[model samples]
Target chain A: MPLALYTVILTQIHSSNKVVQIFGTINMSVYSSQRIALIGLGTIGISMAALHLSRESNIVDVFDTRPDFEQYIHKTLPIYMSELPSPNTDPRSSPESQPSTSLVASLVSSGRLRIHSTLESACASATIVQEQGPENVDWKQTTWTRIEAVAPSSAHFWTSTSGIAASIQQAKMQDKSRLLVVHPFNPPNIMPLLEIVPAPETSAERVEFAREYFSLPGSRHRPVVIRKEIPGFVGNRLAFALLREACYLVQEDVVDAKDLDTILMASLGPRWAGNGVFESYQYGGGEGGISSFLNKLGGTMQTIWDGQGRINVEGDERTEWKEKVIAQVNEAYGTVSAEQIQIKEARLKDIIGIQMKDYNRHGPEV
Target chain B: MPLALYTVILTQIHSSNKVVQIFGTINMSVYSSQRIALIGLGTIGISMAALHLSRESNIVDVFDTRPDFEQYIHKTLPIYMSELPSPNTDPRSSPESQPSTSLVASLVSSGRLRIHSTLESACASATIVQEQGPENVDWKQTTWTRIEAVAPSSAHFWTSTSGIAASIQQAKMQDKSRLLVVHPFNPPNIMPLLEIVPAPETSAERVEFAREYFSLPGSRHRPVVIRKEIPGFVGNRLAFALLREACYLVQEDVVDAKDLDTILMASLGPRWAGNGVFESYQYGGGEGGISSFLNKLGGTMQTIWDGQGRINVEGDERTEWKEKVIAQVNEAYGTVSAEQIQIKEARLKDIIGIQMKDYNRHGPEV
Candidate 1:
């Protein structure tokens, strides 16, 4: 990574109106107009902060219960920042690595990413409060209540919970409309799947506001507005349903774990990465679109469904399946190594970069 | 797409020997030493022929029930062959298109891709006979019987059936051990997922032989040997399971088709494309590995499983779900236009190319 100075900071407006201003070193240490208070700096919180820092025009006050989180951020957050797709990339096809390490170091030195000892201090004047604390319902309720009391009334409250409905988390809150789940898949800044799941009470205005904020100019994040808060939500439900059958296949000895993955990576992986299921089938239907596809193959789908095994992830079945999967996964690929994980992460980032580039050039829609 | 000629054809040995022998155009039209008889030139047959022809060394004898099949191959086979990843590509990063039209024209003019009026004529003197006839059982049985009677006694008999067990297809044949299901997903040339599903009677030697054949040097195909023939084989079953949950979610009004697709394309697509199911979960499990993941999230998975709704595609529910999906898909994406289809195909190919490049560089194995 080249040494790129943070001498100039530009704040990109999230709407039709574009505003730009220059800040000198005198105000370089000072935060930008947007004060995003990211509470509970675990996976989601740290990642969100890194994303904000990448913009060079935001300030994030972060706090977590863990005492060593500050040090952890110093060590770990740079990796996430570095993996982010290069901004204003000239190449539209392949992903290019950006020199983000020095920029992160500069931001850290300038105190743009402030550390707060108390949650109240973090939420004191936050424009947006993103909470990614423990998954415990009681902890979430209490945390929201506390943050709401300290945070400005106009602050946009966001939770990073995966399964917990925002309505439940906001039950004890005074301003229910302000709170909603802004769940990121994991390592928030890197993976672009930021699901903005609004509770029934969450104002439509805020949902739209979030849609714009997370999807700023040149932003890589793909924020999806899930209409309702179904358990596991849309993404996880889709993933686990596929996984259940995957596990069942392994258990049935139809194919081992590695073979199953090879089959998928070769076929469905690229298919979904490009068009997803419905559109892929639309193509499968030939000129008839998805309608033709359902007519031709829907019956077979039903047969497969009826015959699909229900994997019991609990009790003895879990034990039996686990033994089988672990042995097979280990046997085929052995224990996952850091090199393997690194390569996997690199490829994931590259594909996402390719998608984002297409999204930019072709306005690649859903 | 340089105008690389078939003036020199090389037969690549599909094993450790990696033999390469060049022949002049006088010998090129005569085909390579390995004569592959492709019975039934529909989707699978045309694609398999294209894949084989990509290697100048391969001579595929083709036959189809359709009367206009010869013209169809002249027009359609080029497209499939063109889409196959370029041979000995240097970049190892992005896909580069080749000037394959002239090459295909040359191959056709040279009579390298031979078309037969009868299946017997196509398979009569072949070293390997791959059958991709209609889905009807009787048709498959009759076709196999005819091919087995005329095809060389030692010729490998392979079927491209999706569901029918090899045992059932070979029931009427004398040499049952010689025949098995070597199904390729959709277009065999473009897709690499070739499942070699052998029945109880299929010799282990034959299974290994099929594996070696499909996974030849620099071959794009990734073949998986299914221990047993299961419904939908493996790929379709996994896909339909995911699609089932997808339909259920749409039926419950949890999300529309486009949003469901957006959620998947943004999250699971790249994840699976890069690492696949078990491998992705291995990373998902963090340091403790997949065991830790099952232990931590197994309960939530069970809850999601219990609450999951079954989508019945065989009855009234099919109509209801179909109406909902068709409307939503059309509304969100409009009718799938040819341009849309083209872009989708390009992206899919690009991602697959990226994966293949990684496979080559990292020696990426299942």
Candidate 2:
């Protein structure tokens, strides 16, 4: 296919779930039942496994050093799956039959969701790898090299590293083009954003493949192939920008931490949820659109940016800014426990579910 | 009522919509029935009128210099109303009667929704005034002074000014305490936030009154009282911080403006929609809570902030940064139009409706 046609196909696939064939390439069915290897069992890894295994067409292989990896997933998979939107809930999309038993039970019993005794065993038949290992530089480099030794030479490698760039992670690998960063927003399964950061050596074709593959069935992930590596990628960088200003406001006693959260939840939060910052401002521009908004508000925006509280502390030791903020956070939210995380995750899931449903009914941009 | 009791009652009112009467003060039923006068008939003013007029008990009075103000509201209101969640849709909230005719027709045909021939006539009987006048300091000062000359001396004031602090606007007024900024996020009727900004002279009692008043029947508003009058206030300040960084990234060719928006819409937008930045960070902290998150990621956050794009340019004329960003914006979204905005607003209303419904079913905090 022409490169232009290939790009168009990828964009077009955003709305449909039919089996996509590239003639000379692989066949990607609705579920794309590929042999997938999950190398780690962190929260992200577990979430990814649950999502992949639940898709009836996937054959997920896993290996974790933990003695109780099977029991761990057995207990956690159900909890994660419970929060996901019911499959085929979108009336606009095609529907498929669900298995009679619990998804985890059915997958496990049928051996579609397999646990290998060794890393080599897990990678032996795998065509794809999702490595959510420890966030250490040396650890990732060594792990990828070992996986390469056993896994298929053609097996594509992905990492969930939030901070590390893919170039560093793929340095030791022989097939550099196959390895890259597909960092997610915390839980890999739920958040729709996947920052696809390919190393300098990674191929363009592989980037498209990663984008299409991550966006396959049973995934809410919308892959954005990052043009070039930047620190913190896109989402975190944007998040930290807001976070820095929030920290400054609280430090200055402009508003309490709780009120800061309340203000965002009431206004900017929901506004952005439905519309992007740029588009929201474009709407604010009235009939003139974005250029008009930029021309009119660019000065005010610049003024606010100049006045933002400086909270760029370099060390790990608590800056007075961080100290005041953490104190406020505790005072406002109290000592958050595991149950607190559970409650928030549930709410986040429901929030995303509502978004996805609307996304299905009116399309994603709507 | 004692001051302590008065404050407690305001907080309590958040959960219940029953008649909240302070023995010595005025009675506030579920639908306060407050006689509200709206000055100016711009988009904000028209939307505010629609919201206020829809409530069964409100006696809405509106006036604007534009000769077509009456005809404009007649045509614009129904569109805004269409975007709001259906009145009393929350099953958890008490049921209310609906007028048989279209809300605008029913209210206008009756004396309940009055469009006065002059500003003096509109404010003549109004107990609470919602001013959505043009964005000018002198215009506001003169308008408020004029309204105060005729309106009830006891009338409380609210302005929809995004800039020009209330203190500056109220400097010329006799009762500065009554005229604080109850700034709404764009279209006041549909968006759920009302930023209550008080001048130093503004009394505490008026703050609570504005809070309860804006949040009455047929309103989706959740008021957050600004502790101090910072420039751009909280929501806009946070928004600009993110925008500045986005502009920088796009300018630097790290990402296109469209992809930047895609990253946000897919991740942070919806994440923050369901969760506040602080609360979300606290969740990211896991069992360790906000303190852990701060300790672990604070350094990285600081680094990102230190490197954020600085686009804070003063003066209204075009800046290179602004030019690049505008070119990119036009390139990405094409020419934005009135029709485009309508689509977005409809989507925004649905997003907020979904949010509000969830909020009702499981308390706001849930």
Candidate 3:
């Protein structure tokens, strides 16, 4: 069964302005009504649907192979379709199972989202085909191949894969330049930053269109170009770098985990809300600013920036730390049951949702 | 003429709860109205007075060698008394030019903030003495000797010194236990975190009192203790460590300064509001958490923990960098005159002030 374009939701349709439209390379214009077909209903895929559906009325169609997906969809989304793999299908025992791609079809039948069988049916008259397949290169290549074979040449192909270059995967398709990457933050529904990395083969017109489409009202989206394909792109590379040092600091016992948190929360974190790291340093060194800061403290910092301390990843050293952390948490605010924690998490999610609403309403002031 | 506390201010008596009394060691209580004498009005002294008067009703009698402080105080604070150093105050001249060591009679001048000529007059009858003297040990020793002789034993001594140990300075005072370091962050009027480091010889009771004094209501203060003195304390050490890497990264051209800032702003800065580096990793790695993060990425991090790149503080390197950084700023944000930049900066300051007021009024929920 082919997914219908009427299933599309105008997530951010500005009636006065009409729906936000993006002109794709193949003369396809993506509006609010364009049906979006998603393959692989994993963590990333599920989060994308949650974000998309939370907006105006963007209908998301999903497919997966899991038999118990109906239960999961009930937990993850309000409305979804459900389909089970045929009883005759056995990924291990039957060659038919390989062709069926049961996982792909299961994504739709989960009752929380829509799903379709063939790529032609999934992307029939669709404006966009978002491939949320596995991170592995060969797997993505195969997925793109299938998408290209089934979908019309006019459909814009987007991948939610991180760190993988669009060109590498695009080469598997006939119209390679039509593909681009929209790597979003983990739990994309909650975080708004989306790294839009386009292939060298991708055109400026197509890239601009994707940027505009992602920036629809009510969507907390920020896009930065990869410029060139680099491992980890921009955000992750910097994040991983910071995380790496944080780990070494903990492992070395330079400061306890709790106090280290206090150091940041009480000092740097609040300042960071208004200014980023470089800008904070810009103000921190006073009139002399960043230059003075570098001159006065650079030597001291070099001394402290010793080789990475050995990490205590194994349970032995960390077990004590783990218990201590749990104990400290319990001490500060009594130990919460799993259910209570979940309830609190949900409330936090609500607060975050409200914040996004306020942000959308106000927009970025500067 | 010892500076008189009761002589200053409108003295609008409010309810007991509105008084904001901070209980000190033993049965002594320090009210927000306690006259705080600020000695040595240098950069640190000026900043401290601004912060103290920003919210508190502390009568600040400030003394400085420079006579032209009235213009600055008039602009920043509604309350303050300024005193000029004796005329012909030159070391090269006769010793008679310098004010006598008995500072009480010479310095104190009756005003909203009683200007004091000597340390004795400045500390006389004051509940707290905030010393912003030179960082030189000899200068501090001489100043403390005079302060101890004149200040009542009941008064608590607080030093706004950096890097120097509280214990080392306390050894010169009669009331050693009452002396503690209240090292505030740069631009103390803006940044709220205060390092509440006590000397080894200082009593625990004094530590508790100091903490309470800074954390009073209407006071946007965060007090952190260092059980033992470490050069630069916790915040600076941690801050400098991060800064060194940023500089090194810029020098190596791994990333531009602007891009580095953008990466931090988009990727990890927001997350930092809720969780610091350690807590962020603890949560970032998922259930396995910090341990898992270390296990997976620790090796990769170790590979990149290289030494700081070349930095030239004087002459060619600095001059070149200054021009380059300024040009980069202009290129990024467009050409603007210094006056225009200053206007932009002032606007940012106003925004920060409003945000801070809102945060203090409503607490961190905003």
Candidate 4:
């Protein structure tokens, strides 16, 4: 039988949990491969693609308007799309700055990639298409609609958006049931949480499939149902509530920003990373515990609880804080740039992750 | 000068700095040879006295109305009061059944200890006194009045009460300046933070002295000022806010108690232990930092903010929650032993303290 015929037969058997072939090259009858496509080759997009390629899978295909296809494709994968490399700094094409093509070219030379010319050609046989384009709703809807017209009907479409509801994007897809949201935290490869929120019409089978596909052995993935689309979603909504108060305290001058962080650092924050909020109160509060504590003082807290503030994406207060922080930074350690701080923070995060892993394996006593 | 005259001159200089002089075989500073008078040897009182005697360069004088203190007191710091330890375990002294005393004795055998009798005799030129007695306001007032009559005016007084104003205790002291509320967050010696709140009339000089005294190099002593005497104090006030919601959620069946703890453990809690509610928000709310985040979401949070159900302390809600918690404990952990849990918690607290010290030095990144 032809390899294509054998592959088709194997895919059908695998879907039903049965083995159809047991030859050398096709040792596992269920080892069927699916073509995966990329929507935009921006920073987030490229990173997502790189991570997938880095998995060393024979299943990935790269598609971008950028003619620089060979730059990012893993030699084990293939890239196909309309010609002309995306302008390195185009906000609509790449969300983050494009890395030098040398990095992408190195992956391609590893000997397992193909570059293609058109969007239709890239999506013809693809089973999964991840859209990591500009965040603008209109732009996303338009781009997704065009991709939907070309991609295979069976392909699952996933959006990597932080705030937008998956259903809204899914509505633009021809096969809405296959559309879902896979909101990975920044630097997804490092942060273990991937929030899998499905739209109202999304199927359970697809959601389950997505969960299995995204979660590795050590990843901490959370499947929180939106039930209904809300402004910030669950994590952000709760997180923002805490953030609002933190910001209000700084703005009100109740506590210094660093001191506030220190207070959390000393007591609450690290604990939260280990135990959730309620358990913490259980351990921290005396006598009747958390419930009793609330009865005693919740009224006062309610009266004092300030609502969320407006988003100043421009970060006016942050700039002021930065100026003050710079002075302290200079006094403490001469001077340091934001880039240096980010680098230091990144390194610190890596150390923390290693420590956490060790802690889990050895128990906290060690 | 004559020997008596020289003694008076030497004592004056020592007392002026608030440090007592131990002129036995060796002339050691009061701190190095600490004389701690623990008044009212109730559960909390005896534990603290035993802790001080067992752990450091300290002497303990435990005073209580009970009539049989010999069995509990270490021979080194034998109890001697007009009234001895109560034969029947009073609710106030119920904690005596625990291993805390043995733990104290073990720590004491390592070489740091002493004990005494009589308020006046116990406090004779002593550096510190820990008052752990009845919680009644009038009872405390009368007890404190007696304490003022005998305690050295310069000695610092640390009262151990779950929830009471330091000012009230100070009002009965001869020298209000030396009175402070050293309220511990359960299992005092183990928990690193000792809420050091001073009374309204507490002098700045005395506050400074007390801060330094508690600072004790390796110890993590947090000095917080209560601008006004509010119920539950600062930590509890904040803790209550979270607990109220926990109860609300449980009561409303929005989530189970265990599930709630799990959610917090997985995300918010760990960060909170290190950063605190305010700092977590500052970092989590985006680059606009805290203030901007607050300005953006405070209004919305306020809208959704349901403080707590209006349950009177005597209401059925409290009893219901208690029952539910008890039933859940039996179901989940097999047996429900509050005493055992407390001991486990105390052990955990010590571990938290050690980890916290390491955390402060290296920060959450570690």
Candidate 5:
């Protein structure tokens, strides 16, 4: 289906406000309704469930092969929502904003979000199905084969695997153009980065649709499209590059892990928060701009690049480096507790929330 | 001299409030006085001068070989100060704060900050001198040779060369232990990262002094000591690593320069601003922390690392890549103007100022 036609159908459904029946048992008003199927119940799946439930308007269908799936959702959904920053608690949020608690409650009470025992029922009428079963290619392929049999022909698919290629996962699907990779940073509900990587078989309209849907106003997510289907995409590529150098510094005895973290937290972290590498370099040029910066400091940058470490974390040194790094990390941050993780997440939310507010006010033109 | 004795002498001078003669002519009351000399009046030099003059207490002496040094300072200092967020204008600043205008004027009227005709006059009774001459080894060596003969024996020095090794630059000096590399991120006053890298010959006491002095209360500079000397130190190394990948993406047609900047500004930039890489990964591990993070994702990280690009900007591809990047950057940013540069610097100051305020309120226990 053409995106324009699909959008038109959605608009018509929203405006009609007519009642619709699914499985001849559930009745829902067709007012901006979307049937979103979540095809796993792991950590990432639970976070996605909370995100969808918190919106209160989506019909979220969840499925997992485990027998304890229902119990897991019952036990974990409340905890996930509690960890999320409420508008009332967030300093950046206004008083009149909808609190996450009420939204999740509404979704549950209205039966708009529910768990299903079978994949056939979960994906029966899904307009958008998000698959996050496991990282292994075979497991994903098996799950998708089941999903492809029951999901609506026009339903768009989102694969949440971090490093798996979209092409390999969708190889057996009949409608290959509908499947694309929509990997998120961990704790997807909290962290806003959504890397969209579409395979060559995926349609351009679907990629555009994914980008727009994820970055819609009040979604609280930032979407960036990856032009090529490389492993790890952009975020991890950039992140691991930094981690590689950080490990090198520690291994080389230039600084301990604690001091390295201190250096980054105090310096690069804040600077990067405001400006990325290229922009920072442009500013560093001091009125001369990036051209002058390249002219003067390009040699220095190249020298540093040549000196950067090439340590392999999966190689022979993995055990030693891992032991050293873990020891130092544990020393710096005491035993990891649930409360400590909550505190860290809260701090991250505060930092990112304030930055988003500032970006809305004085961000670069894009 | 021992730090304890140095502190005692400074305390005595402050308590006595006796008149002291500098250069055998100028008489001033010594009350917590620090005579700081600034060499070279280029872009970095001017920012450093504004920072010192804004402090309202430091006696700053400046020198540049160029005959237009005075004119340049006169023309540039006000613009820099005006670009700085004023206490009256910044919502985060207190009402009773001294405005930057008065601070700059007071330094000039009281003869606390003066332009010197020669290096001899500039180094004459200096307690701390910041040298920001061109980033050339031979020029820096010659400049230091001239400065060593006239500077006070106990005076400390800050060599602000970004990539040059401090040992090579200070080889001609008799007291190599007093000089250390103190590289600051561009627009030194605005960006708070002060990388204190000490050479092998540098004294431990001097390194400690440098760390404490730059990070003094109200100094608005965050200092991180480098335990060992390395080219580009930490900030630039990490920065170039990110930039190298960014350029690679553009070169490989994964994304354009504009899209790459957009991706970073939206995702990695904000995340890094709040938490550095290791902490982010730790947080990403959910309940298991860094151990779980590495256990599950270490292989994926290694895969990405192996696939990373190895473009050399100083080698055969330098000209071609440089031309391509400059074109794209120019297309994205338009012609970089002075106004645009000032706007970026001001925005950076705003971001850092607010973050510092937050740190003062609810910072980590470090």
Candidate 6:
């Protein structure tokens, strides 16, 4: 047989799962040779591209609708790359002092990252297609449909929409099993969380493959599987719940936004950083554990929950409240300058680096 | 006037708040000279004593119902003191390697910390009476009454109860204005949170004094004023809200307790460690700020809020669930040994130490 014929036959076999194992574990080593198609040139898209490019040796083909999207990437990619920790550079060096010249140059020089002007070109041979378009139903639906039409039948689709459900986004697709929500927190390149929310039709084999692929040691990403699809998933749901109560406190004049932030930074922040809610309570129970803690404070917990404020953030008064809160926050934080924000992010990265180091030493525990 | 007559006149004038304030600002420098009476030598009491002794030169006279409480302090005080960041000791020293002999010796030899056999002796001249008795309302009430009987008229009372409201706890006191709940997280000596939930009768002057006293530069405690007497205050309310959702997720089997903890350690934990929920969303809004964030995701937030599971930790099913969670937690954390718990605390202290350094340099920003 001709070389092209052999390649086509093998691709068909792989896509049909005739060659891919069904009951046994899939070899994660296949990711090294896989091509990733990144659709959209927004902040998240660029961040995902930069992270994948710098952290892994996989070939990344990026697609965007804008004519000058390549120029935009060239301009913004450096900033995302700068956020990454370089092995050769001193980790403690001032962020401003150390330029990301070598890091960006290395990523470019590797010749593994490419920009495709058309979506069809980007998805032609990709094994993984990560869609990060605007979070609109129509835009996401159209984008996924186009990608699905051109991408290989075996390609796994990861939608990076923060709020949209994977099932809804992939409703029009022919094979829904390959599509899922792979939401990343802000600054996707740095923050380790990658919430993998699989659709109902998403195969267990594919979910396991993604879990292993994203959490592979070299990927530097922590992939959390969300078995059931729910609004905001886990991280944001928990965060917004905390945020709602915080807003209620401010509304009640219990504590100003600044003082409330200080309280969290000093106590709950550090506590949560080491141990999550249940484990913290478990520890809070002392030797008796979570049972003792819940038994002792269950009444107080119930009282607080019952009295928790139900402020309507989407109501007509939201604008007035936002204005008041913004003024108060500005009074406390001064103007939120880009420089100040960058400095804050740097500090956060440093703290997370310390935590990651500790986790590496002592495996993940409360 | 005679020396005795002159002293009596000075005391009366000082109690009247005439001589106490030399100028507009009350002399906070006097806190160094003011003695502290720590009533009840339980775990919290000992932890509070050790922190006060190690962090300040204030004389701490502790009293407990147990006859061998003195020996208990002699043995356990060292461990708590060792957890403190010693200015004289190396920061990188292992927890097991560094002994707190010199630290304890200095506190003892300075004539600053002493064990009192009787409550009256401990409270006779104390300017601050920190009551850390058992959580029982009767025990707290009787303890406070006894301390109030002997403590000086100008002394401030701090109740270290986690669940009981300051108002209910102080209802029987002669002067409620001076009593407030000074709740602290576990390992009080290391964790910096001091949730000051004031009673309705607590004077503004007293509140300001308590705030400054706990958060003063050298005190090494971050005090947040809970302006209203709400159940669980701020920390525990927010904590339990998050805990409820976490438990719900565990119950639903979306993720196991261990995986759920991993998700937090990676995402919400670190994010909140640097920025509280409100500020994080503010940042999440990108340059548009929090208004933008809420406007974009308000609907989704509402959905999450509505769908959030209302878990009843006090219900009968709690026991069964607690057993399952405890088993899972133990499998991950190895039965919660005291030594392991201390190590966890030490790690938290180290993380907080790094954060404190950053905050001191950058100052607190929302």
**Two-way DockQ contest, 2 vs 6, winner:** 2
> iRMS of candidate 1, one decimal?
2.0
Q: Sort the predicted structures by DockQ, highest score first.
A: 2, 1, 6, 5, 4, 3
Tens-digit lDDT track for model 5 on B1-366?
466565566567657985333223312222245788999878778777776666666788999989787766666776555544455365333423433545445556789878889999999989888899988889998888888889988788889888888898998888898889888876665777788999999998778787767665567677888888888888778778888877787877787777777667666766666566666666667567688888898899889888888887787864466667767876777665665554555455655655554322245532
DockQ for each model: 0.53, 0.55, 0.15, 0.16, 0.45, 0.48
Q: After superposition, how far is residue A117 of candidate 5 from its true place, in Å?
A: 2.0
Better of 5 and 6 by TM-score: 6
Tens-digit lDDT track of model 6 for B142-193:
7778878888898988988888887788768898888888898876777788
The order of the candidates by lDDT, greatest first, is 1, 2, 6, 5, 3, 4
TM-score of each: 0.87, 0.87, 0.67, 0.64, 0.85, 0.87
**Best candidate (score: DockQ):** 2
- Clash total of candidate 2: 1
lDDT tens per residue, model 5, A264-345: 7666776666566666666666566678888788788888888888888787864466777777776777566665555555
Clashes per candidate (backbone, < 3 Å): 2, 1, 22, 70, 0, 0
Q: Which stretches of candidate 4 lie over 4 Å from their true place?
A: A1-127, A131-135, A185-190, A220-229, A247-255, A281-366, B1-33, B39-112, B115-125, B131-143, B160-162, B168-175, B186-191, B220-232, B243-260, B273-366
Worst 10 residues of 4 chain A by lDDT: A76-85
The sequence of per-residue lDDT tens digits that candidate 3 reaches over residues B1-366 is 111222122133244333423322223333446667788776568766655554435566776656665544444342221111123332223423533333322222423366655667768877778888777778776777777787777667788887677878876777778788988765455455788878778877667667767776656666766666656666766665555455445554455667656555554555554456665555545666655655665544433433223344344543244445534433444433344333333332332333332212223422
Off by over 4 Å in 1: A1-32, A88-111, A317-319, A359-366, B1-32, B87-111, B317-319, B358-366
Say which candidate scores most in lDDT. 1
Per-residue lDDT tens digits for candidate 1, residues B1-366, read 111232122322324355444333222232335678998778788788877777776677888878787677777777676666765653324445543556656775786777888888888888789988788899988888888889988788899988788999999999788888888875455677998999889877668667867776777889899998887899999999999888888887888898888888898888888877888787788877788888888878888988877868778654467779887776776666766665666666667767854522456543
Pairs of colliding residues, candidate 1: B1-B98, B1-B99
Candidate 6 off by > 4 Å? A1-31, A86-110, A315-326, A359-366, B1-32, B87-110, B316-327, B359-366
The 10 consecutive residues of candidate 1 chain A with the worst lDDT sum are: A1-10
Give residue A335's lDDT in candidate 1 (0 to 100).
72
